[model samples]
Target: MEHPSNGLSIIGCLRPAFYDEESYLRGLFHNEDGDGYASDWKDGERLNFNSQSAGANICSTLYKLEIMRMELFSVYGVQSSISLQHFQDAEPDVLVHSSSEIIERFNEKGMKSNAALKSLCRKKGLNVEGANIIGVDSLGMDVRVFSGAESQTLRFSFKSRVTSGRAAEKKIQQMLFPRIQRKKFKAHDEGLKNLDSF
Candidate 1:
């Protein structure tokens, strides 16, 4: 059955405070919305993927999350973790040999919440979609999206990991209205600017 909120029903409402896994994933990798997963990975060697396929990194990440359970999920990647079997008996949902199912599910849910990220991009007139999210760190994330026929992934570094949805929305606003860049000077030169130089 589908989740009432249209997310991974398997891990339904186990933690209502951290509800909406899709949005959580999106926020986790909010950085990867516009590009492929691998290139943006800072520690590429750690991923240990044998194939360099289009969505391999994302697939690998999701696979690890499913297999390792929520305990070690945060250690691998993402700001938070959600155990699929938190409320039930432990059993493998998707095996390594056939990981496509888990990857597809991840893609579906991740994309569903991608709309919020896309809206952010649209307000900036970026015209991009949060195609797939690759990784999530404590501070920010990486997002994968299609740029024409090619896939390009970019990093979205946040000031901090969002603790709540409202906080996430506020952070997005902060991203939207970035601090104006200003010329820098030596410490001693800081107070030498003329009042009318503005």
Candidate 2:
């Protein structure tokens, strides 16, 4: 069993309660052996790793410590592939390929943020490729990223209020809900040279 208060190794998405192949990658990177482990065939004939808490395990602490929190209230909203901007100066013209515009924009801008956001994102290792800053609203800012691929997003909510410094880490940890760790398989030895240790 993992010690209490340790963070997750498996990456999880709250909007879509699911785990994919990438979870394994998260497992290998965390604990070398403690958290990641292979199970017997009876245990679903698969390796085993830890699971994330269903929801925020330390929300109270977060609220108290993080003066402001950027909760991703919603995400991954997709629209129809067709857009009027893509067509020529007339109607029913060739539909524009969504990806073409993304490439074009990247050419104009380096696909990076200004000095401020860039510094913050770098501290968090954010991938801001193919992003567009539309406008600012009550939600701080309206932005989009990754025109076609697995378009990821980021929302920053900063209230002037003050919170406990200690709580900030846990708040971000649970919200991000980072990737989990996995263990390796114990294969049979090629030779029977040593039963002596046993």
Candidate 3:
């Protein structure tokens, strides 16, 4: 039953745009007279998880999204508030999930779609069998290749979160010293001219 994997079938690429960052922030925190703030978030906490507090904050954020049904599958690349129950060609498909056989079929179809999606996923050593890395993003990557070049695109979400690093003062010193040297040379030239008058 392995048919071709349609790139559009991978689904849900643009739904995050639906998220209201300001509202989300407020929902996380629920402030009184000011802005929304998540409970227990300390100042200077890392945005991505590396420490215990950072990890806890991320978990809190995910918990909130889950409560909002924001983690479900997409319908035609748009986020579905309900599970895959009411798609075209198959309003009945949604009604069928209660049956164990239908549920298994649904699950199998999903797994197959995921397997097709793995055609797009990549890490350091893992490479797509017949694809080219065309783009990268915060959460995932994209590749260009399919049996039909026009078919089967993939967006591979990262297994680990990326964190940003701040520049250290020592590194800044290395960059500025050369500029300082040029300025000092011009000052020395002025000083030599002044010494000529003595």
Candidate 4:
């Protein structure tokens, strides 16, 4: 997935919920800061390095943090502080569908959210060749993008949780349109450089 200027890894709508700071801290047990993994269950957050750590370790720790967050919510019942906005459902032609519902409706099928997400991405002038919508939650979506031998999971958060598909698409457009323009401008500049070489 393209990295937008807004810092989102991928674009998708999030569900509404209030987040508890204490619960979030409780879940953050990695490195010396989090719970140690020296137990029978071997369940804990272990951070062997910090921001100055190696790139690979940093990536691993980031994923570990995500796990910690889910554990916090599941075991501690910590809800996000963010709330969802109520909106009337729109026609399917206007928007894809309620992302949460679409995810559920197509759960049995592999890569269920692919089509909807692809449409959204394309609308924002993004490349969706190797992009996959791995998971969609109330908070947002987990989008996995593959580039050659490397892949990355990007977390995209929504400003508000929208009920209808149109609202979701509109929200994404608002968040991404500006960033998409920047990306296009950069690409065009690079193309111009190549033209000079030719």
User: lDDT (0-100) at residue 16 of candidate 3?
Assistant: 20
- Model 2: CA > 4 A from native: 1-118, 161-198
Q: Model 1 segments beyond 4 Å from truth?
A: 1-111, 161-198
Query: Tens-digit lDDT track for model 1 on 1-198?
Result: 011111222232222112224345445444455544332233432222123446553333322233334333322233445555663575442232333332343456554346645655566457773455454333554456554665555567777665543444455445533443112223325656554377
Question: What's the lDDT for candidate 3?
Answer: 0.37
> How well does model 1 score by local distance difference test?
0.43
Clash totals for all models, in order? 15, 12, 3, 12
Q: Give the higher-lDDT candidate: 2 or 4.
A: 4
State the C-alpha lDDT per candidate.
0.43, 0.33, 0.37, 0.45
Query: TM-score of every model?
Result: 0.27, 0.22, 0.21, 0.28
* lDDT: the better of candidates 3 and 4: 4
Superposed Cα deviation of residue 1, candidate 4 (Å): 14
Q: Which candidate model has the greater TM-score, 1 or 2?
A: 1
Which consecutive 10 residues in model 4 have the weakest lDDT in total? 67-76
How many clashing residue pairs, candidate 4? 12
Name every residue pair that clashes in candidate 3: 29-37, 29-38, 85-94
Residues 73-155 of candidate 4 have per-residue lDDT tens digits of: 22112334222131123224322335656445444444534544554566656666566555444445556665477655666
